[model samples]
Target chain A: MPSATMLPITDVSACCTNVTRETISAENAELLARSLKALADPARLRLISIVAASEGAEACVCDLTEPLGLSQPTVSHHLKVLVDAGYLEREKRGTWAYYRLTPGSLDAVSSLLATV
Target chain B: MPSATMLPITDVSACCTNVTRETISAENAELLARSLKALADPARLRLISIVAASEGAEACVCDLTEPLGLSQPTVSHHLKVLVDAGYLEREKRGTWAYYRLTPGSLDAVSSLLATV
Candidate 1:
């Protein structure tokens, strides 16, 4: 397993001026695709919408579970997938887990779709 | 299995404000996800990039195969997938098939990714 405290190096080169400014490389495409895949599911889409429309652009596991009409674990599972893909960041406060949309994640995707 | 000359109906109501202005539905999300899935591959990414950089933002099957480092049949297959997904429109000119990025396809996707 990878070390717990070490930040990922792959992420450093994986930001802006990438998929937008330059022709997206295959490697970058895969990464971006994986991120997009997180939003690929309808359940995930509603999750994003529910959270996005929430105050402060954030939501917790408790608020999310009921609206999605799925089991808690399933909701958590999807949230984890979103977080793993870098779309959402997770913050654990006591018994609750707060999920917030990361800045620039959606914009990068937006820029990629922008026609010249 | 379906007859030709009768264009697809799915393309309608599948456009603007679908992924952007409205909260994406499960069915629509699936459709868009499948479309995005077609672009999820690296070869397809390169193919799109190459085509975008081409004059008139279009390319033939011949211009794509070599750069993609894939067999002709494989390249053709990817183009078909793009066409089927509504991302690229196909026109068979003589013995060659010319593929052009469909209007508003990229922009609708861009709009969806746009935050606020």
Candidate 2:
């Protein structure tokens, strides 16, 4: 398994300007599409909602699995996709892994949509 | 062939609130996911950006193909998906078809994202 402490480097929002502001470059389209693709799954969308509604916009892996009715590996895979896309951040506290929305992360996507 | 004047009815945005504000229902997740899935492709994203940057946030089918390096049918198909997903509106001008982003349509999706 990869180390849990590494911070995500793909902040897709920062890489693309608002789509409405101009004709997006092909590269930007691919980058933004990658992020949206991560969010396109129903389970992942619900996982984001559940975590965002949790106290402090954070939840442990334990709290997520039961509510999502998915196995730990499946939930973790979805969470990892969100993390790789820069919507969620992961932190290890002793034995459990906690996931939190990157502050204003969802807003970045909303703001991009508004640019149109 | 279908008439171009018919308006879209999906309006997926109005069906769901911010994901951050509540735990999204399974149905809403499916709806939102469907819209996001429509947007997950790079070609579709670029098409939206091009039309949005055009006057009135609109573009004709004839104006889209060259810039996109895509065939007219392909562009039209993507536009139809976007229209069905409630991001774009279609209007017929004589024999040609024009597409425009629904007024504040992008903002509705943005607002939903903020709800998360």
Candidate 3:
């Protein structure tokens, strides 16, 4: 019997299969797609790129704001979306918050996209 | 001077940079993210997976609909989105339209995602 918590996640992933011969349930597909949608914006993409290209592959809000030419609040909003998507991690140092790539997050997406 | 026809697409891609030292223009970021968005749906994700894993890396709409458990029209719509995004190529064979992966489209996305 399937547990209650596990079922919904599986259900979302169950709707589809991976590119591999192994079938990917639609439930898995849903989850994967949701994550992808999070990075679907140009602002978010640039944010990821900027952070990845940063001196430490991490950065704070002030660094992003001027480069993006967007307001602080807007940059904050986009950063929130990235955090929600698992593509980034935000850490606060005193009054400032810094964001960095979550390591394998990109690879997870890449493998999900890979055909072999 | 920028051409009238090129500005909109350029504007969209203008918000991003690649994680490399080389810099990815925001214009490129917008174009890349939109393409990513097209694949962000499970229906579309499965569609790409199926085609990529197909015998000739090609399949028709009919082959896709049943596996996806979606209406033909819905499957058609997703395929059209993929086609519009340059992920899949549609070919007409008599009364039916077949969709196949366009060479390098996936890699284009991968490179955009690549940070080094």
Q: Alpha-carbon error at A86 in model 3, in Å?
A: 1.5
Ranking by DockQ: 2, 1, 3
Give the TM-score (vs. native) of candidate 2: 0.86
**Candidate 2 C-alpha lDDT tens digits along B7-116:** 22235665667787889998788777877888888999999999988987678998999999999899889998888777788999898888987777677777878744
**What is candidate 2's local distance difference test score?**
0.79
DockQ of each candidate, alpha-carbon based: 0.48, 0.64, 0.46
How would you encode candidate 3's per-residue C-alpha lDDT over A1-116 as one tens digit per residue? 22432222223333434444454567666677777787788888788888887888889999999988999999999898777667788899999999988766765565555554
Candidate numbers, best lDDT first, in rank order? 2, 3, 1
Q: Candidate 2 on A3-111: residue-level lDDT in tens?
A: 2222232455666688788899997888778778888888999999999889877899999899878999999999988888778889999998989888877887777
Q: Tens-digit lDDT track for model 1 on B9-79?
A: 23523442434345666555555566566666767767776777777778899999987789999998888
Interface RMSD (Å), each candidate? 2.6, 1.6, 2.3
> Native contacts retained per candidate?
0.49, 0.79, 0.51
